[model samples]
Target chain A: MNHFIIKNRKDVQKLSTLAIFAGKTMLSNGAETYRVEDTINRICSSKENIKEVDSFVTQSGFFLTLEYEGEIFTYLKRVKDVGINLNKINLVNDFSRQFVNQDISLEKGMKTLDEINNIPGYPKYLKILGGSYVSGFFSLMYGGSPQDFLPSFIASFISLIILDKLSKFNLTFFIDRFIGAFLSSLLAIFAVKLGIGVNLDKIIIGSIMYLVPGVSITNSIRDTMSGDSLSGLSKGIEAILSALAIAFGVGIVLNLKSKGWI
Target chain B: MSVLLQFMYSFFATIGFAIYFGAPVNSIIPSGISGGASWSLYYIMFSILNDKILATFMGAFLVGTLGEALAIKYKKPATVFITPGIVPLVPGAGMYYTMSYLVGRNFNKAINAGTEVFFMAAAIAMGIIVSTIFTRTIRRFKRQN
Candidate 1:
């Protein structure tokens, strides 16, 4: 049976060290799932006689579920030669350097979020619109079907326009969400009616990705896995709440449309 | 010629991501080259198998293994260099789009796109986890001797 399993605590520690290091890299680079998956693959392939591998990345981190179909002793000898150490992982360093950066004053934080909301003129809105348009174009170029691209483009454009015309106020977490989802639904309907052959799935999903909270969720999970439970919890909650906000925004717009309100 | 261009795109795209993510420009070349080679493998597998999931893992494995070799030589975290190389292949934004669309409306289209994203994620995750476990377990059994 060829598999990568840690029979003792030392091996577990070694793997953890690599995971912590890899988690840091994943967190910094927008915390995309692919990076996290790639890191796990890198770690597993580091050893010798690794035949037949499988792995999974959850919010928790990478867990290697492998099957070893190679000679045992030679593989152990190679593993010993790798010079991996559990103590060198610097759990504290990883947390402090990456996860601890979020301690900001409420005043400053709110102000920044406010600025993002309150910026006058349509240029910023158009910029977002333009980003969506290009993103759709790139998405199509990269193999998205026309059914996916056309509707998403219209939805993005309309949503941005609606967002632009809406009154800029001091944004609250909840209110921002309401506006976002409301506009998304409107854009979606417009796209649907325009006969652009839009797929509702494509437009809504593409629009939301611009602000999806992937990095935070990945980081929170990484922190918790590395033993920074408190920070991880906070970050996790933040990520989840933000996701909920987007969901709420999208939901409201959807519900409104069902009610024929807009 | 087009395949060659796609390889270059994957290669350059990986390098650009590496720099953007804080890797030095000096190391970017080797990293990109490795990533490009891996993507070439991916292109081959995807073309042959016509399975994006299989292609993703195989390409990812190649990139990761080659990246580990590079890390041993360079003494930096394999992730710093390897991640950028594989990222272009990961479907992050794609999955999110699928999900949001499902939530909004269009059940049929949403299900189609969403399933693709879900399977891709699952496939990638399974590949990484299984590979790691396989390596670790083999070593443990070897140690008993």
Candidate 2:
């Protein structure tokens, strides 16, 4: 184990930078705010001669301050494009534990963090298949007949492709979900009209399950219970707004169908 | 559908979501099991109790407890398991019905479905909180000894 010593201001700056980067990776990848804060503090305090470490993390950004050798260095990062990727969170959690226990050099730690950040998620085709399975099986679970399964799968598969395409344009998450939900319901209706599906409501429910804010809802409550009320409230609002967006999307299609417009 | 079929469907659905969310590959099956078991519990409870909110609470509680146990065993964070496990229980159907009611101009039905949706969400939150507290307390006691 290397004895990592903070010998100068430059080393201190490097240490703080590493901590902030790790925190950013976690936050943007949908880790809880409290976990982000804890990871940052643990990383900063693990090295030698660090006098103080404080980190404040919210849904949008984070601020970290570290004191070493009579110098206080602070880092503020505004995180964007928050998405859910549980593998990254797990990797970072492991990295922090390893970092705190072993004397890993600051530069080495930075390199490892970079590697972790660059790791790609599952391939597109598999993710598409995964999305289809989610919707198809969910319809069956929700009491949809076996005939509805293929329709739910087809609707969600195409809409997930649309969602993936729309995300490339860097649209806000709300619009992406709105369009996704709208397309899925429309497709579900068409499937029924074509006699490919027997139950429109079941198909619609299953297809739209892809857009529900399950992660945000769970994280919001977990954050609040852990005393990070700010993060909790923000995530709760996010969940509500996404739910509403999905509702509006599906509601419009259902309304059109009711009026025989479709 | 039989309980066995519901469990099987939820298992595959949970695995699909676990992959979509990029959970670690080794942890996927464990999460699937937890998701399947909890959804089956929810199905049985809803049938017997006929209370959506209480049934949801029970389902969420099972997910949380099982997730925590799996996290400890796999040496990964709990969120990896809990996030995917809870998806089947989220009130997606209620939200859809609520919107349809509003669009059909059935204000009373809309309000009724909307309130139940809100309460179901809260019930899920409460269930998770209680399970977390339960685990933490048990850990504390073990450490004290």
Compose the digit string of candidate 2's lDDT tens values, residues A1-262: 3478878889888988888989999999999999999999998888768877899999999999888878788888999989889999999999999888887888899999999999999998898889889999999999999999999999999999888877888988788889999999999999998999998889999999978787898899889989999999999999989998999999999999889999
Q: How many clashes (backbone N, Cα, C below 3 Å) per candidate?
A: 34, 0
Native contacts retained by candidate 2 = 0.83
Q: Candidate 2: where are CA atoms >4 Å away?
A: none
Q: Give the Cα error of residue A175 in candidate 2, in Å.
A: 0.9
Worst 10 contiguous positions by lDDT, candidate 1 chain B: B16-25
Candidate 2, position A169, lDDT: 89
RMSD (Cα, Å) of model 1: 15.3
For model 2, which pairs clash?
none
Worst 10 residues of 1 chain A by lDDT: A77-86
Using all chains and alpha carbons, the TM-scores for the candidates as numbered come to 0.43, 0.98
Per-residue alpha-carbon lDDT of candidate 2 for residues B35-124, written as tens digits (9 for 90 to 100): 999999999999999999999999999999998889899999999999999999999999999999999999999999999999999889
